[model samples]
Target chain A: MPFKAINILLLPLLLLGVMVGVWSYIALKIPGFPTPSEVWSELFVVLSDPLYNNGAGDQGIALQLGNSLARVFGGFAIAIAVGVPVGLLIGMSKSAYTAFNPYIQILKPVSPLAWLPLALFVFKEVNTTAIFVIFITSIWPIIINTALGVRSVSEDYLNVARVLQLTPFEKVFQIILPVAVPFIFTGMRLSLGIAWLVIVAAEMLTGGVGIGFWIWDEYNNLNYAHIIIGIILIGVIGYILDTVMGLIADFFDYRKRGRV
Target chain B: MSLKTFLKIDHVDKVFPLGGGKEYVALRDVELEIRENEIVSIIGHSGCGKSTILNLIAGLDTISKGTILLENKHILSPGPERAVVFQNHSLLPWLTVYQNIEMAVKKVLGSTLSASEIRDHVMKYISMVNLDHAKDKYPGEISGGMKQRVGIARALSIQPKVLLMDEPFGALDSLTRANLQDHLMRIQMQTGNTVIIITHDVDEAVLLSDRVIMMTNGPEATIGEILDVNLPRPRKRLELQHNEEYLRCREAIIEFLYSKFAKDDE
Candidate 1:
């Protein structure tokens, strides 16, 4: 067990060392690209007063990240509110599923960025358009996964509900929701991931006060080290979001409880 | 002693659609009359439609061509009056043992009984199944036998007129199966609840039932023979090992399943 624990720490550190070696080589070749030490110094500077606001475009890294998060969450919350009920409606009835499935299939694979121009024209505002793009990117998984969760409810559980003569409302709350919650969380997790992924690109296109926009602004100003720092920050924050989502999903999952 | 006919199944047929203008007949001309407070076991090989019969009675499945009446009331849809103990011990995995039983109690008796009465009612059945220690434990935490005990407890807690158990102990190991069988017998004796159990186990049928209803193999299955298990109640597994009636009942089921209507593929 102790050996396994050592390997867990050692193996990743070994990979990181190899990656930095490759990165440093690339930086030397590229001339303007930041080396590992340069990016490390920039990270310290960026982390040092993350919430400073020096007008709209010159906000601190934390403020930029906070704005991106606000837009992503705004879109994500709306997607959940709309997606869950629609998914449940489609899940419980064959007619509803038949009506909606074709459109879902057609629309799901279309890129969220593809909708940006239309959203920009419709909303006539940058933040609204960014949030709208995040919504588009995040909604498909929520609807599809939530529906999958409802369909995955066992016949045995439904039989118990029927035998008890549970009212439709009681059945949905006491039986269906409990069974579907884990699935809904799975959807939400996926939705949040896509939402985060799209927010960066959306902010870049919209010229907004967000992490994506800041990264682009740094690139334009030729402060290449800050771009690398931004990449690391985004990666770390996305990892944290995914980890938190996973923990929440496990909490609601009945299969995870008491069985290892 | 003459007993009142509590539940009746008349001329039932179950046919499944085979997609392309064809159908598969699962059961045909299925008939049964279960007495009040009596325990009946429907035993057969796999695909014998014993479960279909139970499903029909429980009103979980619609009858193709027949009527099922519990106390002369037509069984149209599933209700709290006919609670089922499923083969998989279908206790809601999310709810604890107490809460699982409590959900049924609250739903069935919620209007008639107050909150305190409901709590007492749930506790009564949980104790009846001897799962007091595991009351707060979730279904996934307990052993298979204990889960089935909770399943039985939940079914009984609803105060159903007929308890329908579809292969309730089939999933458990033999030792656990025996333990649960003993638990079931004790509970049934105390409550005097009418139970119709679907089983493929010949020994289980003879041991737990007042009458073992043997079913023929399907493509149109029906009750083949009804063997009377006249062995006295509070039947201990050890004592029944050498009892004449017990052996006779076991032999009849084996003979019916193996000799008269055995499945060639099996």
Candidate 2:
């Protein structure tokens, strides 16, 4: 067990070393490929004054992250508000599922960015358009997962509800919701991840003050090192988001409580 | 004994639609009249439709023909008057044992009782099953036997007219099963509640019931024979192990299941 544990810590570090070594060799060969050391220094430069605000188009890293987060959250919240009820209705009713299933199947496979042109044309504002894209992309997972969660409720639990003569409202709140919560949270987590992924691309396309736009802007100025820094930041943030979401999902999941 | 007909399952039939205009007859012309405070068990082979009978009585399933009546009131859909303890002890995993019982108590007795009164009612049932120590624990935290006990407590807490259990202890180990059987017997003695249990175990049927309704094999299973267990109350398992009446009842059920309508597949 100790040897296995040691390998867990050692393996990632070994891989990271190899990656840096390859990058340094490539940087030396090419003129400006931004070696690991260059990105490391660029990270410090970016982090030094992350909250600074110069203007609308020019802001610090933290402010850019904050703007992106606000949009993702805004779109994410709307998705939950709309998706959960729709999911429940479809899940509980045969007729509703029959009606909604075809549209969901058709719309789910379409890329979030595919809606970019239409959204941009209708909204006219870059921020609204970006948020709209996030909303559309994120909502599918929420609806699908919530419906799956609702469908996953055991017949035994529903029988218990019926035998107890629970009102329709009571059945939903006491039986259905409690059973479906873990699934709903799972959906939310997936939706948030999708929303985060979409927000970056949406910002890049729409031209705004976001991490995605910041990376694109750096590319325009030929700041290759800064782009690498932006990529690292996005990866780290996404990892953190997923971790936090997972923890929250586990918290709501009854199966995780104490099943031996 | 009053000999009052507390629950009547008269000429009931359950036909399940198997699509393509085909149907499966699970139960046919099943008739039973349970006395008030009588402990009746329906014993059968795996596919004898014993559970289907229990479901019909609990009003959890529709009767394709005939009717089920409780105290002369026609039973249609599931109601609090008939509570079922499922084989898997289907306690909501999210809630603690105390909370699980409380949810049922609150739902059924909420209109009649205050919040504090509801707490007392829930705690009372929790103690009846001797699970007060583990009441605060969630269903997932408990052992299988303990979960079944909680299932019993939840069913009884509602003060149903008839308590229906579908192979309630069939999932537990032998020792755990014995323990729950003892618990159920003790609870039944205290409350004198009318109970109908569905089980495959021969000894369980004889030991627990005043009447054992032996069901025939399926493809349209019906009551093959009904053996009367006239053994005296407060029947101890150890004592009943050697009792002549207990041996007779157990043998009668075993004969019906294994000799007459033995299911080869299961």
Best by lDDT: 1
Runs in model 2 lying further than 4 Å from the true structure: A4-11
What local distance difference test score does each model get? Answer: 0.91, 0.90
User: Per-residue lDDT of A64-104 in model 2, one digit per residue for the tens?
Assistant: 99999999988888989999999999989989999999999
Ten residues in sequence with the least summed lDDT for candidate 2 chain A: A251-260
lDDT of 1 by residue, B8-52 (tens): 898989998898999999999998899998999999889999999
Instruction: Score every model by TM-score.
Output: 0.95, 0.96
> Clashing pairs in model 2?
none
* Quality of candidate 1 docking, DockQ: 0.73
Chain A TM-scores of all predicted models: 0.96, 0.96
CAPRI rating of model 1? medium
TM-scores for chain B, listed for all candidates: 0.98, 0.98
